[model samples]
Target chain A: MSLIDIQRISRLYQMGTETIHALRDVTLQIQRGEYLAIMGPSGSGKSTLMNILGCLDTPSGGKFVLNNSDVSVMDDNALSEIRNREIGFVFQSFNLLARSTALQNVELPMIYAGVPKSERHKRAMDALSAVGLADRVHHRPNELSGGQRQRVAVARALVNRPSILLADEPTGNLDSKTGVEILALFEELATKGNTIIVVTHEEEVAQHSRRIVRLRDGLVAADEILHKNGAAAPETPVFPPIHASAHAGPPPVPPGAH
Target chain B: MNLSELIENCGMALRAVATHKLRSMLTLLGVVIGVFSIIVVMTAIRVLQDSIETSLSQFGKDVLVIQRNPAISFGGPEVWEKIKRRKRLTPDLGELIREKASLVKSVGMQNGLFSGEVTSPYGKTEPSFSLLSLTPDGFPAKTLSIVSGRALNSSDEENGRLVCVIGSKTAEALFPNSSPLGETIKMDGISYLVIGVLESKGAMLDNSQDSVVIIPLSTGMNRYGRSPWGLTILVQARSQETYNDAMEEVRGILRTARKVPPGEADDFEIFTNDSLIEQFRSITFAVRVGAALISSIALITAGIGIMNIMLVSVTERTREIGIRRAIGAKKRNIMTQFITEAIFLCQVGGIVGIALGIAGGNAAAYFFNVPPVVPVDWAIIGFLVCAAVGVIFGTYPAYKAAQLDPVEALRYE
Candidate 1:
């Protein structure tokens, strides 16, 4: 089964007696280990779609199946659980706890997941090291630079080992060089078979992903798959590998396919 | 939540409080004043009440005194006039109750001359001593222990001997350099030999307990007539279990001796150590209620201040709350975080208030000549009240924070 399957989903907002249709009859499927970018302008319904996919908000109608669990009808608490276990979100701004150290910020999701203290500590350390921020674990958000702060946020998103790493405008606040560095980190994570979804209006940020899904007027405008190995793996991959963990998942893409 | 999670929340709460030092301190000051007001008054009351109980206990719990007026009266001057119009208890009433009341273990007569001066060859004290006269039984009933020599014997009262027992202060004044026992002292132009000196009794209700002189009943009656102040009959019961029975027997004997008809109230007042303590407790109970009510007003005002600050905190940290929610914190977690912060502030204030209140109240206790007391129960009450106030005032703001939409809150400028 696909990791995420959304069929004809719709989201409506009521503003002073006017009904605003943020999403209307949008359908999409994402297999495991697929690096996809969702692109749109403001009011293009991409933000609404990301909110639905991240389980921060439930769809007003239609079906959303994440890991075989129907999430469109789930309540707030259930959505939180799904968000903790299956989705990792990185915001445009590095949304770190201002008072907590980098390790504490990274351990936040597992805290809600009821992970034991010692284990949570170990996993948080590993997540920070994975993002090359091992030396900055004890530093607070204000003490870290803009790029380092975003790195801490990414470590926090990855600490729970969620299936999909979802980022919304992750490098919007960084300089071009720092943005390229973050995109390289995302590319590295995707190459290692970790499923990645990024929402950005910037084409350069979207080019790092293998697939692109564009939305306009609350509907899917285009869905395209780019070939990484010329005509060999086909332009569009009908199926993606499922296991994405660095240690215990499937073998790391046959070690040097290029 | 588990212990580890609680510790994490506490750490967060502490960090938040530390960051906003001035605001937190101002918030804490309100709670401190509220708790201090309550604990200080309560501590003073507890100490004063304890001292009164100890002093009253000197008149043994099983002992009763028969007098013309009640020890504590609530009915004002009109009742005092009526009681004064009734018959006075004479020395003969002691004899009458001793002879007729079966439950009475012993009966004695006592009288007091308000203030008098005592002079020795070397020194003389000011007119500050309460001159008392009593039979031998009066010593045990008053729990007056002698430090030296002997108390009055039966022959002293029967023969009207010129002998007396001086209190610790009186002994100090009259003898200064030597023992007052067997020394001759002059009072009211009369000479008397000091037979005994009482042990020190410190002070009670701003009065020095050691400044007293005790002589035999007959001697006092002969020297200072009983026209103005009549004798008080002292009756000791066999044991505490038969105290009520003993009181009834004395009441019956006194009624018959005073010639009161049946169905009429006794012409005299009968009091026991227990009754005096009870009367004191009733009066102080009212004071306690008043103190609690007044302190509660302060606490409510402080509680309102807490709610206001918490609301402001929630508004200020709106984006932070959204970030936490997006990071997988549920509504309950956000609520816990805010409530814990509120409780942390109150607990700190409550502790400081308890310390200051104890110090302040004990200072007041010293002025009242009562021993200082540490009110453990009041301390515990102060802590629990702080927690209750935290919860009561913190809920609305925390709830508002939890209900904020994460999408909008993160977008809040």
Candidate 2:
């Protein structure tokens, strides 16, 4: 069975006397280890769909089966539990706590999950290292560059080992070079058998994913298979050179610089 | 929540508070003042009460006083007039109690009239000291120790001798130097021999206790005539165990001696050191209730301030709440975080207030020449009340933050 199965889901919003349909009768299925991108313009209902898929919001109508559990009718508390265990969200704004270190931000989800301290710390360090931010673990969000902050948010999303790594406009706030580095990290994560669902407006970001689902006017416009399993991902710029511009000045040399 | 999670929430709350240092301090000021007001008053009252207790205890344990009026009375001129009209307890009442009350250890009659000069060849003192006229047992009954010379003996009273005992201050004023014993002092056209000097007792309620003189009751009556309303009877019980029995016996004798019928109440009043303390406590109890009410009003106002700040914090951190919610934090966790922050502020304020209150109170006590008191129970109540105020005021704002829709909050500016 698919990891997530959505059948004819709809989301409605009421503004004064008007009824606005954010999503209407949308059907989709996502298999495990799939890297899919949902792309649309603003108000095209992609955000609503992302919110529903991430279990942050429930659909107005239809079933949402995540890991074979029907989460569509779940209450807020149950949805929170499911979200914690099954989904990891990376927002467009790199929503890391401004006062906390990168490692602490990464450890936040596991803290809510009641992970043991030593294990949580170890996992958090591992996740930050995975995002190539091991040396920046002690730096707060304000002390980090935009790209580094995004990496901290990605590490936080990946720390819990959730079933799907969902990102909403993941590169929306980053420059092209930094955005490419984040895309490369996502590609690497996808290659390791992690399912990733990215919602963005940029076709360039969607091109790196294995599958592209396009949304328009609260409905799916097209679903295209861009690459098969074990296939080469669309060219995302390599890391070190891209990171040069991630920090505005000359690259901050590591403590043990040769 | 687990200990680590609670710690984590507390850490977050601390960070938030640290970021807005000025705002948090302002918010905490209200609580500090509220707590300070209460703790200071309570500490002062405790210290004063302790000092009063020690001073009153100088009248000796298990010693009762027979006077024309109660030791303490409340109300206006009407009540005072009635008390004033009661017949005096004369020296005969003391004799009757000594004769009839087997549990009585000793009985002495004294007059509270001390408006007279104490003169000597060396120096003369103004009429500012209290003079007591009593038999030999008066010193022991009033816990008045003899620092030097000898107290008046029964021979002095029986023979109507002009021997007198001087208080520490009076001796200092009358002799300045040299032993007062065997010295002659002329007063009211008569010469009296100094026999004893009382120990230096400290001030009571800011009144000088050391300035006093004592003479035999027989001599006082012979020289000055029987004081119509100034006679005071002192009775010492055999022991604390027989105190009530002694008092009952004295009452019965006085009633019979004064010709009060069986059905009628005694016109005079009977009291002890304990009764005086009890009356003082009752009066101060009203003051304590008033202080508590005023302090609670201030605390409630402070609580309202905390609630307002918390609400503002919730609004300012809407996006943060969204991020936390999306990352798997339950509403309860969010609520816990905000409430913990509010409670942290109040508790910090409470601790500082308590310290200040104790310090301020002790300062007042020092000025009043009383020992300081900790008032442990009031401190505990202050802590609990601060925590309670936090919870009472914090819940609504915390709930508001927790119940925010993650989707809407994420979009909030």
Best by lDDT: 2
**Model 2, runs deviating above 4 Å:** A228-258, B59-61, B67-90, B108-232, B238-242, B252-269
| Model 2: lDDT of residue A212 | 85
What lDDT does each candidate get?
A: 0.84, 0.85
For candidate 2, lDDT tens digit of each residue in A1-258?
A: 778888778899988999887886677888888889999777778999999999989999988999999999899999999888889999889989888999889999999999999999999999999999989999999999999999999889988899999999999999999999999999899888899999999999999898788776677767777855566543431111221223233333332231
Model 1, span B1-413: residue lDDT tens: 55666777889888988989999889888889989988998898788777777766657667897888776667788888888899766787788887888888888778886587889997998887878898999888887888999999899999999999988888888888998878899887888899998887655542455888889998898888854276777799988899999898888877877889999887787887778777877877877888788778888888888889999999999999888788778898889888887888788889999999999989977887777899999999999999999988989999999999988888777
lDDT (Cα, tens digit) per residue for candidate 2, span B1-413: 87778989889888988999999999988889889889998998888788777766767787998888876667799988877777777777777788888999898777765567878999988876666688888778878888899888999999888888888888898999898898998765678889888888865443345777788888888877865367778888999999998888888888878788899777888888888788878988887888888889989999999999999999999999999999999999999988898999898889889999999989978987876789899899999999999999999999999999999988888
Whole-model alpha-carbon lDDT for candidate 1: 0.84
Clashing pairs in 1: none
Q: Which one wins on DockQ? A: 2
Worst 10 residues of 2 chain B by lDDT: B202-211
Report the CAPRI category for model 1.
acceptable
Q: In model 1 chain B, where is the ten-residue run with the lowest total lDDT? A: B200-209
lDDT of 2 at A44: 74
Docking class of 2: medium
Q: After superposition, how far is residue A41 of candidate 2 from its true place, in Å?
A: 1.9
